[model samples]
Target: MDFRFQSASPASWADVAADALVVVVTSQTQRKLEGALATLLKEAVAQGDFEFKAGRTLYMHRAAGVKAVRLVWVAAADESPKAARAAFAAAFGALKQGGTRHVAVAAAWEAGWQPAQAEALAAAAAEAAYVYRHTKPSAPKPAAWTKITVLGEKAEAKGVQEGLTRGAAISAGVTFARELANRPGNHCTPTVLAEEARALAEEYGLKVEVLDRKAVEKLGMGAFLAVARGSEEPLRFIVLRYDGAPRSKAPIVLVGKGITFDTGGISIKPAAEMDEMKFDMGGAASVLGTFRAIAELKPKLNLVGLIPACENMPDGKAVKPGDVVTSLSGQTIEILNTDAEGRLILCDALTYAERFKPAAVIDIATLTGACVIALGHHRSGLFSPDDELAAALQASGDKALDPCWRMPLDEEYDEALKSNFADVANVGGRAAGSVTAAMFLRKFTGKYRWAHLDIAGSAWKGGPAKGATGRPVPLLTHYLLDTAAAPSRA
Candidate 1:
């Protein structure tokens, strides 16, 4: 969909010749409404209707003197950023439901809304209108909106326009991430993921390389291979590099744990809800999604994305509990539980990342259920020994509204991974499971400043609204943008 900004007054918005004119209505906006629109809104409110509450919407059809077919009033409980995003989503939803082909949003920027908020609003609207029907029979098409015009003061036009552009790119990235995660494991195996990565690289003119099982073994990725051995699907270590900066620049490396379908191998998971393991690759999806955005935005920074794509199944060839495997970093690991396989694959990937001599490395994974229990579905668990990197990530999360709560990565947690037979143990018992998992990955990332995002919580949802949330893509993208915008390090 196309998005643009126009300079227009709220009273003049009705005459814009659009299918619908959407006006955000807050308690302040209710008193600020003037002329014919005010009278109509006041009358609607007087009739025990259109109370201003966050995300509430009231549609007026063919209102007197309004040229547009409908007027959409989206309520905002307060001027908070979250409320603004919710309001925009509600307004767009109203437009979609009313089958409005082209619409104008007369957003009340007077109510403490910044340009970034405007950008977020537009992005939220795009995201809300997204639907995934990849495998289902095609349904009758709904009336699609061809364009969205954000009506604002002349002074705000440039900022709003820039925001709209950035927001659209971010939203598209998010949607791509969701699509990758939503696919069934059968349809999106390790080989399929490599194909998708190659396609993305080709489309964006980025460098792409896919290392097959033989190449991965040649690199001594025993930890990753152990996890892949159980599955018939060929393992792929996919790398996508984007060098928007000079060759001398040190790149930021993102390592993603892509367990396409985790059946928990030897130490199997319960039968119930095991289907959701298709989403185990959420971290990899987010990385690819971030790549999609940066490719469009073209940030002036070198970036490298690594995805260790494979499956973990309970086949006879699967790695069993107490099995010892060597990692790409030459560290040996005693597998205490086959279910704790995310870190196993991630360890080898993170180890391989050292080849880039990255300034910083961040590995994203749906690694531990303990993270889900600790942070619930709201925030991801962040762990890093580097303070500067953690601070940058936290700030990015705040700006994107995709938050993470930092978890400890002390030597105490490292003690939990002690192994009698190997250099480290894969599972570190039940206590502080999330921290132990981070500690396990931390060992391989010693060559560079690194952080780990345990996204087991925020990757996807369960129940009736079950689907991928497309998280950390926003967080990671924002961080890259900020990094690119900053002055070069000496």
Candidate 2:
């Protein structure tokens, strides 16, 4: 999608050229708009054609005194940041039904608009315009709308433009992640995901490497390989590097659990809603998504992405409960439950990240349904031993509106992983399942400042709106952008 900011005064808003014009009312109650349309909006409220309630909107097609073919009036309580985001979201939701290819938005709080408001508007437009039709070839084509114009005060044009650029980049990354995660398991295997990474590297000039099973065996990634034994599809350990800074600078490394399709391997999940297991790779998708955004924005910092891509399926060769496997770090893990496989793959990947000599490393995964129970579907569960890293991530999530809640990682939780035969048990008992899973990965992250994001709750929706949310992409991107602006770590 293309985004632009136009400095249009209130009086000239009605004359802005576009297929549709969306006007936001900052006043608590609906009142007159600017110019000839001032009384027109008041009359709209008086006639009950439009309600004065927040988020209420009125849509008019070929309305009188409007140069545009269509006009939309949306109500907001105020021009506050929260209101701005909600108002734009409502405006775009209303526009979704129309074929407005070129949209003109005349905003009120928009007069004093900041970058946040601009970013909100652009991101909302992308959300409204998105339609998934990749696997469904016969699905209807998306709307022809390709351009979004936000009418802002002349004084704030530069800031608003900057915001639009960021929003466009973020939304694009989110869309990419969603598309990859939405694919069926057959079409989106580990090999396919590696190819996607290779394509991204080629397009963005990032260094890319795809390691096959034999290559992985050489590195002694026993835990990662044990999970891949059940699947007929070959596994691929993907490594991506974006070097935008000097080699001496320690990069921020991101480790993503790449369970392409999880059937729980021998400890197969219940038949109910099993289809959603295909989304087990949401963490990997988010990493790819964040990379795309960073590549476009070109933040002045080095970034490394590691994905231990594979599938967990039931087979005679599958690793079973009580089996012990050694990790790349040479730590042995007893598989108490084969279903608890995300941490198994992630643990090796986390060990692999140590080679980067990263300043900080974060691992993203759809690690546990326990996380979904703890945080519900609203926030991803964050676990970190480092307080500063935890605080930075939480703040970043808040700023981007992709919120996360930090869960306790106290040493007491580490007791759950105590193993009878190995250094640790892959699955702890039912109590504090999510925390224990984080604890398991925490074992391998001893060499770096590490944080873990359990995205099971926020990664995808299970019902009618069932699909990937492309979360953490927004959160991660914002975090990296903030890091790039700060002084280099010593």
Worst lDDT 10-window in candidate 2: 27-36
| Winning candidate number (lDDT) | 2
Per-residue lDDT tens digits for candidate 1, residues 413-440, read 8788999999999988899999999999
Q: In candidate 1, which residue pairs clash?
A: none
lDDT of each: 0.87, 0.89
User: Positional deviation of 37 in candidate 1, in angstroms?
Assistant: 1.9
TM-score of each: 0.97, 0.97
User: Tens-digit lDDT track for model 2 on 1-490?
Assistant: 8899898877788888899999888564333357756867878877989875789888888877889998888888787656777887888877776778999887765347788878878778887777789799886666567999988778888998999999899998998899999999999999999999999999999999999999999999999999999999999999999999999989999998899999999999999999999999999999999999999999899999999999999998999999999999999999989999999889989989989899999999999989998999989999999988999899989888799999998899888889989999998889999999999998898888999999999999989889998998989999999899983531
RMSD of each: 1.5, 1.5
- How far is 455's C-alpha from truth in model 1 (Å)? 1.0
Q: Show where candidate 2 strays beyond 4 Å.
A: 29-32, 488-490
